[model samples]
Target: MNDSRFTPVDPVDLTARLVRCPSVTPVEGGALTLLTELLEPAGFECTRVDRNGTPNLFARWGRKGANRTFGFNGHTDVVPVGDAAAWTHDPFGGEIAEGYLWGRGATDMKSGVAAFAAAAVDFVRATPPDGAVVLTITGDEEGPSKDGTIALLDWMRTKGEAMSVCLVGEPTCPDRMGEMMKIGRRGSMSVTFQAQGVQGHSAYPHRARNPLHALVRLLDRLASEPLDHGTDHFDASTLAITTIDTGNSATNVIPARAMARVNIRFNDAHSSASIAQSLRDEADRVTAETGVTFELQVDVSGESFLTPPGDFVRLVTGAVTAETGVEPVLSTSGGTSDARFVKDHCPVVEFGLVGRTMHQVDERVSVDQIRQLKSIYSRILADYFA
Candidate 1:
């Protein structure tokens, strides 16, 4: 038996150390620091890429412009541990019991970051690849996301650092390991509408032009139809009317203003700009019919993107299948992740542990699965550089 496999980093130990860090979104929480300590000792050129007070780390294991660079992206910061009293184990304890490692970022991703970091460190030490290995870890993925990966990529551009291809270690499997990977993601955007009208006595409805009525009409128009049938690589676009309110407490008075917010997750069939134009046109149509003025504001989180199945996709799928013996399905069904940002820099796909428990109380991951993930990542590095 080869003792070398046990000589260096154990992904499970790294995961436990990370889970113990109190890094809730937008907080450094020492998670990045711990990772930097581990990587630097193993030969990674580590740099703290903090932006606008958001913590981020970028580490590379070889020359900057190696023939081909394989990049990794993940986040160490986690969502807040909601209702700590509701958990059976200490949320920050990183307990290894009952065959699972329990903690806040266990499934949602600290384990993922650890797995890849360990794999990168070990793979480089054991057999130096001709190409480079880069890891980008961020602390603001769970927050506004403006200063996290975006900041890293912006910095990379300014410094002329780039990856030939990138893999995001976000948990993409829903039911079990090796069952799924994300090939693309739907774009996300939000639109808020404010309507103005004349306020008057509710008793004589004819005397008042109620803004609430106009707002409701506008919302209905936006939500009344399907954005599209499912695309070849994505599900149909969806628009959800998240909120509508006027703050009116009196029954006898008609309010002069009302507001509503709608969120849309769109496929490659549309862009945020196109959707924004269509929505503004809808508001105009409603205003023409209702005689009320409307103001529309749009915020786009990310544009829809796809890394068409090719060599990169095949390499990832083959690795997961070889490790877990389950031929994985290529999917783009989940909510947004850092991959949405990585696609611009390089062709990116996501694979990792089962995420059924991500963001839930008592969130935990199987210990064996963590090791298995490390093996999978190790194999990917080997094959990509093979």
Candidate 2:
């Protein structure tokens, strides 16, 4: 290790330090301060943004006024540690037993934050490159994401801080570190459909219109067929009906209305608007066929995008293959992240440690994984700005 401060954060101690801060979503819990302490002294100009009680930081280094800026993005807030008694170890203990640093954010990603910070320290110390580097750290990703990465990105854009490329430190790999990378993300959209019918006694079936029957048919039309065969860099799009309700208790009477909520995870083949139009078309067809009145509401969560294969991607790929001898498969799967918002600014991808234990009881990571991740990120920095 050329830089003393760059050695992989003793995964044990780093995990312990971070978990001690009860940084439940929408709370600071001193995690930002801990991060600032580690970064400020290492020549980073850290700016803490407190927007509506949510904590976000924008830390920058290297030469100012540089056109090429490499960004490392991550979230500090973690999901609530549920049912503490169900865990074999303390949920917030950040314990280092059985060769794992166990804690709430250990994998989902305080570990990634620490490792990336350490990598930045190492990169600057070894060779302060000509281009700039920035860290977009937010504390509200685990909850309602209103005040987190999205807000921070708006501020950065207002300041004219454009990035050449960005790497989000999300846990993208499944079982082994460096085994996978997310080159793109599938888009997400939600729909709420309602069917209305005249309510009447079950005994008088001829006079009553049952909305449930109409709703069931509409749902079948939406799910009976696949959205697509799958995109080149993404999986096949899927439409899942998350919930359905009538809120009626009387079995002898027909309900007046039925409601259903469906979520769609789509590939690069479609946009939110296109998907919304498809929903409208489907609902209309179903309504016409059933002779029932209906209403459809669509919430376009995110439009799909991909970071084309480029210099930045190859650099990270080479680094990972060199360090672990694992050729990471670039993929586009999984749930949405802050990356969805960042995509509008610049090409972005996600790569980090194995995510097998994120958001689960006894969340943990091995010390060795942190060390290799630091090395991988360091190499990426060196290649991008060298």
Candidate 3:
């Protein structure tokens, strides 16, 4: 049951192993095989669940009668490296130069996964915990996410797996590794508005109701005031008009309809339903003002959540302080992430290397940073389950 093959391994090698997999979203690319080959020999049972064509791996290793389980959630799939010519090195080079690993997904996530995998191997090799360590990695986080962790969690529920606290290895730090941990995230929703009007000649002002004029008023009302000043744990919600369309072929003719779309990054101050209601109210006011009728459609993606300053937060913060001498801030300020889906199932937090290069051309992570990240993750495990 000894997994010496994975033990005493360098994080740089682990990152190389992960980057070699061309596991773009929803593609296996042998990443799961690489993970299983390294983990199974360590007395861990690994299973690959292919739900709706997305590959997800769930592996666990520990004592038989373990009551507590710590789960690590992450994605193996990476965003496509657009414009390979723009990168100095091969997007999948996994090369080490200038103290950094050059490749796509190096910093966005693959580094974190590799570091955690190495640390898990080291942890079990040194002192096997009384509890189990479960890794839930999916290949759909970068895509639609319809078949990623969401489906895997459902499968876990059916199998009666007990997950106490989950930590996501997303690139959460802003400036430096261990500088921050994401305890919560803001909710996101998209809205589309369409106003109907009568088409007529531009000179016939009395003959046509201009829908563009009505949409302008509606947008002004939605944008003129702040959604909320700020919440205690979250910043103020924001609504931005992303697109406005009025297909008028001739300048002398008035369009029959107008369409607009807006995206809202909202805090706990509002729910998607409440935001939709606000849109409806504005539509009503516009109708009253100009006698124009319109339709509004709102798509609620996810809700906001906070983990609070608790044992999970303390476990990670203490580890960062001990390892890097940095007091990480617990912040909820960021765009949406798969952690949003995870927060619904368990108290989830995100911590990893700095994300200054995620989703960018020539994405890279420092070799030294990867090693330090492995140490940090190991310390987190020791502090939480020791």
**By TM-score, who's the top model here?**
1
**Worst ten in a row by lDDT for model 1:** 1-10
- Scored against the true structure, residue 242 in model 2 reaches a CA lDDT of 98
Residue by residue across 104-159, what tens digits does model 3's lDDT show?
A: 87987889888888888788877788899888889998898889998878888788
Off by over 4 Å in 2: 1-12
TM-score of 1: 0.98
> By lDDT, is 1 or 3 better?
1
Model 2, 217-287: lDDT tens digits are 98998899898989778889999999999999998999899999999999999998988888788778877
TM-scores of all candidate predictions against the true structure? 0.98, 0.96, 0.96
Candidate 2: deviation at residue 276, Å?
1.1
Each prediction's total of clashing residue pairs, residues at least 3 apart in sequence or on different chains, is 0, 0, 0
Candidate 3 TM-score versus the reference:
0.96
Clashing pairs in 1: none
Give one digit per residue, the lDDT tens place, for model 1 in 108-224.
Answer: 799999999999988998888999999999998899999999999999999888899999999988888999999999999999999998899998878888899988888877788
